[model samples]
Target: MLKDIVDVLADPVDGTPLRCADDLSRLVSESGHSYDVARQGYVTLAGGRGLNHEGDSAEMVTARELFLSQGHFAPFVEAVTERVAEVIDKSHAPEPVVLEVGAGTGYYLSHTLDSIDGSRGVGMDISVPAAKLLAKAHPRVGAVVADAWEGLPLLDASVDALTVIFAPRNPAEFARVLRDDAEAVILLADQGHLDELREPLGILGVKSGKLERMMRQAEGYLELVGDAELLEFPIRLDRASIAAQVGMSPSARHVEAGVLRERLARLPEFMDVTARAQLVRMRKS
Candidate 1:
């Protein structure tokens, strides 16, 4: 699987090209760096300091898999795939390289790959637990464990399109890795999202001005392509689904296990919850 998008990967230390070596068990960089490919089929590309962020834990990844597998976020996935397809068509790349930062479980990435023929993807996440699933998420996907905040381990102008689904982003790094005609699709949770669960589960709500803050952060590196689209849908979630949703999010860390369980038990067996987010498209400035 790593072979699929090996051309887009680079040495995290020097930003040089990397090739498969040692019977495809490791990636060797042009500057003489070697990174072992995990037996699960993913590789870790960190600089000398290595990864400072542990990202999501095993339990959180498992909870995410459980929640997503139930198709609770189908609309979000579909919207991302549609936007990516539009970008690829505009670029007219015969064989495109798509990248997903903080790609958890490769759910959204795998969906996008399925929609585009002859396309490959590199799913990058700092979490090893998430990378393991990402490696086998799709036949054409190459999974990598890398920190986005430090810098993306990708060659300049190597990516055709990128996607970030409720994940961390580095606009500067994104601009460096994207071609002149490339674009990045981002989905962020908007205010009022999961409002019903916040009060009961004691989870934090989506803050206001999230998009404004992000636009400010991308000021010099990238610019918005067009108006952002708001997608709002309602889902009927049962108690189990509610718990999985909370467990997969950052709120899981703040709420204790006992208290979260108690709050979940008090909720009705099935309740309607709103799913809201803003889908933004941007390109290099």
Candidate 2:
């Protein structure tokens, strides 16, 4: 519910404190900006320029939910939760605040919140469909629809830990919103991630120099805590699960439905695919 994380939310336009009003049907900012809460239990916190990016579609979101529900990415989720817990403990926040940017379906945020006591999360995404899922993903999560590039609609120095899993990153904004000792956990797709499915599925490949580029982008905002941790594991996926994985990625848009089905049919009934990614821990600089 919006009331759960209202204290951590801010006006998208001016960063004013926000509170539920009109019987919790809307959120009123201290600056007099009113944002209506959807009956479905989520709020859209776009600023004057409005959201310029479209996040994952409902179909894509559904595919993600399906794939993640099977616990195929358990290792990924575990790494995130472990690091987030450490950050919260180090900060000694009585009421820890975790924010997930571009949080899709709130799966990761939900899991992290479950693992940490006295912690609440703000799941911010640009998709309305994602917001609907996020609103109910967990009891302690407040869902908001906003453009990440524009800047996060959160108060400065309000978040104890921020996690971005296969999502967008706003380093400067993250630094501004994080306390000096707060941590940021980021997961990036390594070059070998899902290599088994790439050629057959005609999917996009992880670009080279991604880590270097990311560090350059975060030059003044953050610094690496230690070394990047590699989280690589193998999973046995059937044809159906493989299809769901492809559908949730950019490959779904590049291939025709019928042709993609043909390609999937030629694959083995079950395959051992490598799921690889690097987890980088950073602290505000």
Candidate 3:
């Protein structure tokens, strides 16, 4: 699977091309830097100082897998896939490359890949735990662990379509990596996305002006393609699903496990939760 998107990869240190070496046990860059591939079939492409952040813990990745596998975010995934399909058709790339930054569990990337023919994906995340699942999530995907804030381990103008779902974004880096006419489809959870659970679970709330702030951050590098679309849906989740949802989010880090359990126990067995997010399409300026 690494071979599928190897051409899109670059040395994290010097931005040179990389290729499989020592029978695919490691990746060697054109600049002579070496990065070992893990036995789990994923590669860590960090610089000399190594990764600055551990994207997600194993427990969080597990929770995400459990929650997403049950199709709680089906609408979000479908909307992403549909937008990507449209972008690919307009780009007309024969073998388009789709890169998902902070791609947890590779769920979104794999789903988008399945919807498009002759498409390859780079599931890039900073988490080793997430990369392990991303490696086997799809046959056409290559999983890589690299910090987004530092700089993506990818070649300039190499990616055709990029997706960031409730993940970090380096707008300048994104603009550099995306080819002309290519688009980056981003999804951000809007305020009141989980109003029902916020009060009950004692979780943090999404603040307003998120989009304006994001656009300001992207100024001069990436431009909004069209009006941001609001996707709102209601999902019926049982207590376990609700737990998984909370466990996989930033709320997990803030709330104590025992306290969260106690709060979850007081809620109804089945409750309807609203999932609301804004999807924005952007391209290089």
* Model 3 residue 104 lDDT score: 95
lDDT of 3 by residue, 1-285 (tens): 898899999999999999999998999999899999999999999998998889899999999999999999999999999999999999999999999999999999999999999999999999999999999999999999999999999999999999999999999999999999899999999998988999999999889988999999999999999899999999999999999999999998888989999999999999998999999999999
Report the C-alpha displacement of residue 236, candidate 3, in angstroms.
0.6
The local distance difference test score of each candidate is 0.95, 0.91, 0.95
Scored by Cα lDDT, where does model 3 land?
A: 0.95
- Pairs that clash in candidate 1: none
Error of 2 at 161 (Å): 0.4
Provide the lowest-lDDT 10-residue window in model 3.
46-55
Instruction: Using lDDT, rank the candidates from best to worst.
Output: 3, 1, 2
Question: Which has the higher TM-score value, candidate number 2 or candidate number 3?
Answer: 3
lDDT string, candidate 2, 7-119, tens digits? 98899999999999999899999999999999889999999988887888999899999999999999999999999998899888988889999899999999999999989
**Stronger candidate by lDDT (2 vs 3):** 3
